[model samples]
Target: MLVASNRGPVTYSLADDGTLTSRRGGGGLVSGLSAIGAEADALWVCSALGPGDREAVRRGVGEEGVLMLAIDETVHSDAYNGIANSVLWFVHHMLYQTPLEPVFDAEFRRQWASYESYNRSFAEALADRAAEGAAVLVQDYHLALVPGMLRELRPDLRIGHFSHTPWAPVDYFRMLPDDIAARLLRGLLGADRACFLTHRWAGAFADCCRAVLGEDALATTRIGVHGLGADAGFLRERAHRPDVEERMAALRAQIGPGRRAIVRVDRTELSKNIVRGLHAYRALLATRPQWRERVTHVAFAYPSRQDLAVYRDYTAEVQRVADAINEEYGTPGWTPVVLHVKDDFARSLAAYRLADVALVNPIRDGMNLVAKEVPVVSDAGCALVLSREAGAHEELGEDAITVNPYDVIATAEALHTALTLSPEDRLATSRRLAERATALPPTRWFLDQLEALTAVG
Candidate 1:
């Protein structure tokens, strides 16, 4: 088996003292690979993101023996920021402001060429590495065109493409140039099987194919959905560690006395809706002044993609809003929003354990793992204020206080309701949600997709 993605299972970072340290990758891709990535012949192929990574690529060294693609910095930037992040990510997430963005001019065409080249590089690498009848699983929007490119290069391989983001509706997706939209659908159709995070996203992809490439395009590709669930066993064991225990004590002290915590763990990505979440918390404090001193919003907004101006601005806005709320409501004894920008996994797990409420309200998401994880680790049970837009809501909505992510007032109201939930009811609901959330562990998810790919092959 071979895995291809823009980011690898591990990345290298250089410290000020000139020592090189490596960190494993996060997210579903890495989680899914934990079961199979260590096999003797398996190779996880990925790109070089920085100078350190480029050096590693030059040395042909990586974690778990990954194959690194060392494309030129200029080409990588154009493909990553210009096309993949700017164009494709915006389109699929329904993120474009519509009037001010998405101008597909001559510059866009230049970027599109780079995007094609980047994908072709991945195809060439996979073609070189894959054995006879080997299964190639290409991940996410960054490599949508890879299946077609790899198929043209090596016809004997079994290819599958898995999308981790929501597919835009037919009308919203057409915002792209006619040629580009059709090319993407055709590219994905090159796979023998195309997978999505939910049946909703899967059906949306099928709808796009029929609308853009005609019905014949969908006949050969077997479309499927495998909603990846949390690894409960892993979470249970890890959350109980000494580090987590130390963190829980630290977080409780930070939260202060006689106050319940409202927790949210998110990157400052646009789709994550961090700004709006802060607004909701502010609104909740404003209207329901009773919760002002009693409830604290312990938001973990870790920095993400700060290189992009929009993301940087969004992160700044998040900080501004959180600060404003704290200043507005803070006293000698209490601060309203306890926002943390630094990334710390143990602290996040600690917050999970101490949370009375888990706020996961992305405007739109494939699946919000935090929604699934908090319940598994909560010490005294938790009330989940989930967004209907999040894919996990489909499975856990029955037990959660569902809200519209775009509506701050409604989300504020939902927060109040969640905060006021009966302890007995909250624990019962949290347990049930935890059970369903981890029904399919990462190993099962990987094996299922592999089994499907093998059966077809």
Candidate 2:
């Protein structure tokens, strides 16, 4: 079996002492592969994403079962930041400013060329490594073109493509250049199976294919939905670890005593809707004055894709809003908002365990794992303030206080309702949410895709 993605299961770093140190990677793919065990005949084909990765490639130092492609630095950046992040991400997230943005100029054409090249490199590597009739799984939008490219190279292989983001509705997706849109649809169709995180996204992709390439475009490709769920066993065990326990103690100091916590942990990505989430939190405090000092919003808006100016601006805006809330409501003994920009997994687990409510209101998302993860590890039952747009809402919405991502007032009201729920009700809801959240663990999700892909004719 072969796995292709933009990043591998591990990263290499050059230490100051001139020795290279390796760090294991995190994410569903890594966990799924670990569950399968190292002895399985598998290779992870990924790009050399950093200077360290490039250096490691140059030095002929690499981990077994991993193949890192050393594409040209400039080409990598153009394909990564310019095309994948700037174009595809915006289209899928429906994030374009519409009238003034996404100008497909000369530079865009150049980036598109590089994007094709980047994907070609992956396809060639997979072609080289795979045994005849081996299964290949291509991951996410960054490598959308690979399935088609690989099909041409090795027709005997069973190819499956999994989209990890929300597929844009037909109308929104039409915003892309006509030919480019067709290419993307055709690319994924090259696979015997095309998979999405939810039924909504799968339907959207099918809609796009039918609309763009006519009715017969999907005749050969089977669409599947696999809503990735939380790993309950891992979360339950890890949340009680010594480091998490220590971080929980530290978080308690910051949160103060006898205060219920409203917690959110997210990277400051534009699609995450961090700014609007903060606005809703502020509105909650402003409207419900009695709850001012009784509750604290523990928001961890970690930096993400900082190399992009828009993301940097968004992260700054998140911090600015958090500060404004504190400045308006903070007292000598109590802070209304305890915000952390740094990313810390142990600290996140601590927040998850201590949360009274978990706020996961993304503008649009394939699946918000944090929404699924919080209930599994919550020490005290946590009410979920979920966005209707998140893919997880399909499963968790019955128990969650679902809100529209764009409606600040409604979201604030939902938060209030979540906080005011009786302990018995909260615990009951939490139990259901956790059960639904882990119905299909990561290992099961991965294996299901693999099983279904191999069965495809």
Candidate 3:
């Protein structure tokens, strides 16, 4: 069996002595693999992402069962940052302003070529390692073209592709150049099964296939949905650690007295809606002056993808908004918005514990785990203010205060409503959200997908 993704379970980093040390990577994919590690004879194939990773590839350091493909830095950047993150991610999330961006000129075609080459590298690696009739699972938007490339290399292999982002509707999906759009669809259709995080995303992909490849294309490949749920037991134990406890104390002091806490923990991803969320916090202050000094918005906007200019600009915008809010409503005794850009797991858990209301209002997400994780880790049963566009909303919406991600004013009102909810109701809702969120644990989710793939063979 083989698993291929742009990222892998482990990454290498250089130390002061210039020795490369490997560390386990984070994310649900890693957790899922961990669950089935004992039973499966699996090899992971990924690209060299950083300097240390490149060095590891050069030295032939195959940490765990991984095969590292060291692509040229320029090619990797064009493929990963250009085509994958900037283009495919934007189209899928509907984040592009449309008129101002995504002009797929000659440069885009060049990057598209790099994207194809990058996916092909993984395909070649998998074909080299996979046994006869082995099952191969390719992951995410970064490697959407891998299945088709791999199918060309080894048609005997049973291949499945899982998309971890929302799929664009047919109209929006056609935003790509005609050739690029057709290539992506054909690439994915080469798989025996195509999987999405939610039925909404799966249906969108199916619609696009029918629109481009005609109605009969569905008969060639099956579509599956597996909304990856949160790991409740792991979160519960980790959230209660002494490190998290220490962070909680520090956060409490920072939050101060006589003020309730409104918490948001997110990477500064474009689709996270951090800027609008901050604006909604300001709106909350403006419309309700009584709560101005009585509430603190603890925004843990951790830096993500700083390599790109757009992500850097978005991150700066988030800080600017937070500063603007503090300037507008702050006093000597009260800071309305307490924003932190550092990535701190313990601090995030602490914020989850102290939150009076947990705000997870992404413009679009495959699944916002924070919406589910917060409920499982809340010390006092925090009310959840979630975006309906989030994939997790399908499972957590009934218990959460759902709001339109694009509507800042509506979100502001929902925040207030969430904050004022009765304690009994908050507890009940939290209980329900936690229960449903953990219904499909990481192990089961991975196994279910694998089991479904076996049916394709």
The 0-to-1 C-alpha lDDT of every candidate, in the order given, reads 0.89, 0.93, 0.89
Cα lDDT tens digits, model 3, 87-197, are 999999999987788798999989989999898888888999999988899999999999998999999999999999999999999988887898999899889999988
TM-scores, all models, native as reference: 0.96, 0.99, 0.98
- Model 1 spans > 4 angstroms off: 15-20, 26-34, 37-40
RMSD in Å for candidate 2, one decimal? Answer: 0.9
Best by lDDT: 2
The per-candidate count of clashes, in order, stands at: 0, 0, 0
Residue 220 error for model 3, in Å? 1.5
How many residue pairs of model 2 clash at the backbone?
Answer: 0
Q: Candidate 3 — which residues are off by over 4 angstroms?
A: none
How would you order the candidates by lDDT, starting with the best? 2, 3, 1
Residue lDDT tens for model 2, 27-88 = 77887777778667889999998878888999999998999999999999999999999999
Show model 2 residue runs off by greater than 4 Å.
none
Root-mean-square deviation of every model: 1.7, 0.9, 1.2
